[model samples]
Target: MASFGIIGSKGRMGQALASAVEEAGHTLAGGVDAGELPGPLALQADVLIDFSAPAALEANLKVARVAGVPILIGTTGLDDTNFAAIKDAAKAIPVLQTGNTSLGVTLLSALVKQAAERLGDDWDIEVLEMHHRHKVDAPSGTAKLLGEAAARGRGVYLEEKMESGRHGQTGARKSGDIGFATLRGGSVAGDHSVIFAGEQERLTLSHSAENRTIFARGAVRGAEWLIGKPQGRYTMEDVLDL
Candidate 1:
């Protein structure tokens, strides 16, 4: 069984991950959260799973690298600079990072890509996502991911054509632009939809997480899949073979 260490031990997702790891017949080496990074994390487990905040990610990743342990990072809210650090760390250890961990979400991304490609840029792509009230990022990482998939399908850079929702009489939607809409409410686990709006037809691809355990399970699965892999960055799409 895989020996696992969780980086965000006290948070909701962290607790869920710990439980899932144990339930999956894996050993929980230890956990680190906030100011509590546990002692010698690298010696305690074969792999590390990070569901912590952006501030804690780099430190935990460094710990993983020094120990030669692979890491599966699930935290969101990291900007390009922080992401660059992750890429740097991947030089020595296998790292798997994902915006969302639900296997269904990765499959939805694939389907969205196919739809965007088949339907062509003539179809406007719009991403709608909703998460729990505590989620910190607007447009959620999942929203940006869906937009990226659409952008990739259209063979364009995401920044050049993606429109993250507009307000105040935004006029008509721009052509070939991928739009994003976000909503936060109650304790929603997650919900994402990709709408391809074209003349006389509309195609919507969506995934809803009824329980956060889906993410926890995926993270554990990813950690198990990452053991002993060569140094590189990977995604859940790789995990699920999408």
Candidate 2:
């Protein structure tokens, strides 16, 4: 079993990952939070799991590179600069990043891609997501991921086709455009649904997260899979072979 180190040690996801590591019969090398230095923990781990904030990504990746350990990043709300950093880090060490680490979500992404391809652009595609009120990001990273999948199937780029946060006087839904709606409240772990609205019939593919354990378990599994991988960027689909 591999020894796993957590980069967001004190957070909810980090604590859940700790439990999952033990449940998977793996060793918890150690963990470090925002203020704590991660270099020591990175050196102690066979693999590293990062569920920390976006701002911490560069530092965590630096430590992972120094330690020469593979890392799985589950943090969301990342922008272009963060992605560029991840790409740079992947040149030196294995780096797997995803908005959600749940196995169900991985499979759901594949299904959404297939459906979007078969349904054609005639069907208006809209992605809806809801998270706990404490969640800071809107439309969620998962929603963006699903949108990308839909765009891929339609042979379009998500950046150009995505419509988010429709307000008053917005024109009618445009065909071939992927729309997104976000909801925040309660203690919802997570919920995502992709709606394909057609003339007569409609189809929806969705997944609900009951707790953080699923994400934690998936992160551990991903870490195990990434242990000896070559320097490169990867995704949950690679870990799950979806």
Candidate 3:
């Protein structure tokens, strides 16, 4: 069994991941929070799993790189700067990152891609997501991931086609534009829906996460899979073989 090290040890997702690691019969190398240094845990673990804040990404990557260990990044709300750091670190060690690490979400992305490819632009695509009230980011990272899948199916870039938060007097919805809506409230674990709206018919694909354990289990599975993998960037799709 692999030894797992956790970042953000005190947070909700971090605690869930710790439990998952134990349930999977793996060793808990140790954990580090925002104010803690990751060097000690990084040195002891076979692989590192990060569910910390975006602000802590660079420091965590440094520890993983120095320790020569593979890492699975589950932190959301990351910006381009964080992604650049991850890409750099992947050159020296295996790195798997995802917005949502649930097996259901991984499969759902594949289904969304197929649906987007089969449906013509006449079918307007819209993505909607809702998370816990404490979530800091808008549109949620999973929404962006689903949008990327849709864009890939359509042979377009998400940046060009994504339309988020329409306001008053916003002109009619543009053809082929992928829209996004977000809601934040209560203790929602996570919820996502992709709608293909076409004349006289509509198709909606959705997944609702009842709790964080699904993601925690997926993260542990990913960390285990990353062991012995070649240095490169990967995703939940690779971990789940989707």
Candidate 4:
């Protein structure tokens, strides 16, 4: 079995990842939190799983690259530069980043793409997501990913034309615009829905996380799967073989 190391080992998601790694019968290489990357990081395992904060992403990735360890990164709200750094690092070592690690969410993306294709542009597409209040990021990375799926279905770039929400004086919903709405409340682990709206009927695809461990389990699974792949940037889709 491949060995595993977990960054952000003290947080709920980090603890969950550690537990999942053990439950999967993999050796625990080591665990580190918001400090200098430990020397042991280089020796601990075949893969490192980073579920840390956005502020620490650069350092975490630096450690991974310096250690020559392939990694699975689960942090969200990465800006364009951060994502660019990840893609650049993948040229030397395998690196994976995902908004949601749940296998179901990956499948949900595929289904949303198919739905968007079949429904055509006349049907409006919208993404609604909710997460714990403590979670940063307004629209949630999953919402953007879902919106991308819809955008791909409709053959448009989400960055150029997507709408987040509407207020007073807003006219009718624009055709070909994928809308996004966000809610932050309670301790919701994570929830996302992709809705296709038409005049009278609508279709929705949704997933709700009951606990944080679901993400941890999937992250560990992703680390295990990534360890043997050729050096490249990847997503949960690759991990799930979707």
TM-score for candidate 2, residues paired by index: 0.98
Q: Would you estimate the TM-scores of all the predictions?
A: 0.97, 0.98, 0.98, 0.95
Worst 10 residues of 2 by lDDT: 170-179
Q: After superposition on all CA atoms, how large is the RMSD of candidate 2?
A: 0.7
lDDT of 4 by residue, 1-242 (tens): 88888888888888888789889998887888886565477567799888778788777777778888898988888898888889888998899898888888888998998898888678988899999889878798888888888888777799976898688899987778888999999999999999899889999899998998888888888888888788899998887677
> RMSD per prediction, one decimal?
1.1, 0.7, 0.8, 1.4
Off-target runs (Cα >4 Å) in candidate 3 are none
- Which pairs of residues clash in candidate 4, taking residues 3 or more apart in a chain or in different chains? none
- Encode model 1's per-residue lDDT on 74-181: one tens digit a residue: 888889877998999999899999888888888888988888888867888889999999888888888888888888889898999978769899998888888888
**Model 1, residue 45: C-alpha shift (Å):** 0.7
Worst 10 residues of 1 by lDDT: 33-42
What would you estimate as the lDDT of candidate 2? 0.94
Runs in model 4 lying further than 4 Å from the true structure: none
Residue 84 lDDT in candidate 1: 94
